[model samples]
Target: MTDAPLSGLPLPGLPLPGPLLPGPLVDDAWLAARLDDPRLVVLDATALLPSPGHDGDYSSGSGHAQWAERHIPGSRHADLTGELSDHEAPYHFAVPAPEALAAALQRLGVRDGSEVVAYDSGGGIWAARLWWMLRAISVPAAVLDGGLQAWEAAGRPVLGEQEEPAPAAAGPLTPVPLPHAWAALPDVDAVLRGERPGTLVCALPESGFDGSAPTRYSRRGHIPGSLNLPGRGLLDEAGRFLPRAELAARVGAVLDDAASPVVLYCGGGISAAGAALALTLLGRDDVTLYDGSLEEWSADPARPLVQQG
Candidate 1:
């Protein structure tokens, strides 16, 4: 893995001009300095996951109430469960059509040239999900490295309901979809059948990946032939991404020459986005997210899954 930071130069697989942020991952200090920039749009893309034993749907909950209670200043809440997702899809948190996504983002004041920074109240998974979505549309966006926890740990001030800003006025955001950024069921099946060349990465926890933990899906374990890289292991105690050296040490061997395009998936595609963000930060732009992930994969009984020893 290269220690070099993502520069202004166009990324390898992503065909675009350049990113608005310095990199795909930004620290709280970096954001604090640009809070007042008119071109900047800060988003609180907080979505709560169901606890292991809970009976809630994977993408059932929103963090709007939590955001109303407290959030970063000047940040607007982006609804991942509702407007930002494809409600018509069979699985939860499915990526919406480009035009639908563009309209939803426009309602949140994302103009064509706007630079966005997304952060979640929990681990960076939800925020990364939004970042991945923005990337699919070729929008210039980045994730808040440590999320709300890190922001508060650094003594950054947060806004309460009383101090919240008014609803963002709509802006003109045209979607330029990058189809290659996503991997569909057929694509994954091809990889499983050995007809395609790619790496299948599962971002779930060890137990979830190995079928030891209870799951909401029709089956447990992971897609056959997947390599495990738990999303939680990608972060430090404070929920920030590990330093580049540490991150490289953890994922380098698994990814080193494994394949050209790395296909990532998790329970409902949320945690996989976190992995995707980590790989992007590591300068591996040849990453594609499985939008349906386990939710779609495990639903079909004909599809196979395997448990790790």
Candidate 2:
């Protein structure tokens, strides 16, 4: 709401704001070295999706309990389905209002100059979602590649429930919206109807895209005219992203055509962020995420979702 800078010239340990994050995707090594840096704000943005056959209850699948049990040392838990999301929205994990988001991040110790690194317990989807949200609001942030699993694999020690640190004092943050970072229903509709020049990408798995797998959404398939590129496919066995060449090989066709922007969407916009992160790593900047994604698209009877041929 207020554009005023955070008061207090120098917080006890936090240094003055430094440069923006190195990039959108930071490795475990990059983060390990900066764990003690006052300017760095690490977050455990872990939110689990419902298991197969379970009710599609996003709230019930929150990762707060897992975060409370164990998490990256000095990192705060970001409740993606709760405080960080818009509860009143029809879709799960909807981005909250700018002011509300700023408030939430501030409460998590995000100051104007803070460089945030977000990681999750599962694949990097939740972390990428948080990174995308922060980027949309002009925050300098990055997702921890491979997430907490990689951190552990690298022998990084985590803090248990008994080792949790005291909550940091709230700080000031100003939200500067990046309009191009998001695509709404109208944007997707325009792209589908040939009124807009953009690529519609579905980040769901092959089965989900082809209507062969059970889905939590109202519909079984993907939006018509969308390309299939599973978000998880971009990762290697260790959950780290594949090398740049391999990443380009998988995503280049859809992204290389500079004539149109790439509009990415998924079940509820969570996995899509992972795809968006991949594109970012590939050095593609002309990408936008469909916020409501299929959860909103399929819910509408007027919208068409077609099975793969």
Residue-wise C-alpha lDDT for candidate 1, range 11-85, written one tens digit per residue: 689876544488788888888877876668999999877666732234368889889888999999999988999
Model 2 lDDT tens row, 1-309: 112222334667888544646778887877876777777899999987864452232334789888988799899889998899999999989999889999999988998878799999988899999999999999999898899999999999887784446546656899999978999999999999999999899999998899877778777788888888899999999888998888998887655654468899999898899999998887788989999998899888788889863
* Model 1 clashing residue pairs (backbone): none
Prediction-by-prediction clash tally: 0, 0
Go through the candidates in order and give each one's C-alpha lDDT.
0.86, 0.85
Off by over 4 Å in 1: 1-20, 54-59, 162-164, 167-169
Q: What is the lDDT of residue 57 in candidate 2?
A: 27
